[model samples]
Target: MDKKLKRKVLTASLVGSSIEWFDFFLYGTVAGLVLDELYFPSSDPIVALMLAYLSFSLTFFIRPLGGIIFSHIGDRIGRKKTLVITLSLMGGGTVLIGLLPTYAQIGVAAPILLIILRLIQGLGLGGEWGGSLLLAVEYAPKGKKGLFGSIPQMGVPIGLVLGTFTLTMMSLLPHEAFMTWGWRIPFILSALLVVFGLWIRAGINETRNLKKRKNPGRLPNYRLLIH
Candidate 1:
């Protein structure tokens, strides 16, 4: 690949992965700091907090399923398309979460919806990491494979830093305002990041392997793999 194309692939890989992870981690931060109050309310703050954590844990278990589903699509369609789907799914989930009604407003439905959103976020993330990693690695020149392989990994720390920074800045608000709306801003603002990531990803070419492996009948049965 030419230098220009390589740079575009690298940028798309890193930025797309980072944005997806940013959405994923940002939910955890919100779950820890705000979910208990907004989604799961109890007289015992401890109980509410624990419930929120439990919801977060549930997302973890659902991730594998997401990975399998998306990977199958990636195998059949292409990495580029699969990643676009996952990123869009993740972005939609995050924005919906930001707009979700609180427990006080919706009673039992609040926490239920929160859990569903978390699951969607988990699924998106499960598929995203692998695609991003491959996008970078597969696009690299023969000698630079190792270097490119490591680039997508950078998304982890970058995402954590961005999530932490966003929360910290929002923390500057008073407790009432922070809980009321400040926390939601970060989640909702993810729309812009998602849009940018998708734009970059759209410009990237599918990996050579995916382009060459378009025979669905020749692909392994994902259901068997899952079983």
Candidate 2:
């Protein structure tokens, strides 16, 4: 691969992975800091928190479904379209949560809507992780494969730290205002990151390595390993 092309792929992988994980990591943060009142206000504070955490954790369950659907699409159709779909889903889900009606306004329907949105988010991130890993390492030069894979891997910790700080800052505000509006800023910020990610990812070239492989049939075998 040309050095210029390597640079482009690396940039795309890093940016896209970062944005994807940012949406997911921040959702976990939101669950703890905001979801209790926003979605499930009827429960006792502790119970609401446990429910929020449970809802937050459910994203992991749906992520695998996202991964399988996306990986197949990536293997059959291509990575670019799959990535675009994943990013859009993640961005939309995150932003939707910000706009969601609070339990006080919407009553029983609020948490239900929240759970549905979370599943969409899980699906998006499921695709994001594996696809970013493949996009980074697939075309990397020999012996540097681990390093290339590590670039996308870095996005997870970066996202976690960002989420922690964002929530902590919001937590510092007057409790009412923090609950009312401060949390939305993080979700809305995802839009800017999504645009930036798209700009980088739009330029990534499809891997010719996949093109050379006539045996897409072997892909299903990977599923057993995934489970």
User: What are the TM-scores, per candidate, against the unseen true structure?
Assistant: 0.93, 0.90
In candidate 1, residue 39 scores what lDDT?
88
Candidate 2 regions off by >4 Å?
A: 213-227
lDDT of 1: 0.85
Candidate 1 local Cα displacement, residue 85, angstroms: 0.4
Worst 10 residues of 1 by lDDT: 218-227
TM-score of 2: 0.90
- What are the runs in model 1 whose C-alpha is more than 4 Å off? 217-227
Clashing residue pairs in candidate 1, if any? none
Candidate 1 local lDDT, residue 40: 87
The sequence of per-residue lDDT tens digits that candidate 2 reaches over residues 43-83 is 47998899899988988899999998898878876777788
lDDT of 2 at 160: 81
Which lDDT tens digits does candidate 1 get at residues 1-227?
68998999999989988888788789888887999888888899999899998988876898888887887788788889999999998899999999999989999998989888888988988888877776787777777777997888898889989999999999999999999999999999999999999999888787776665546644423432111
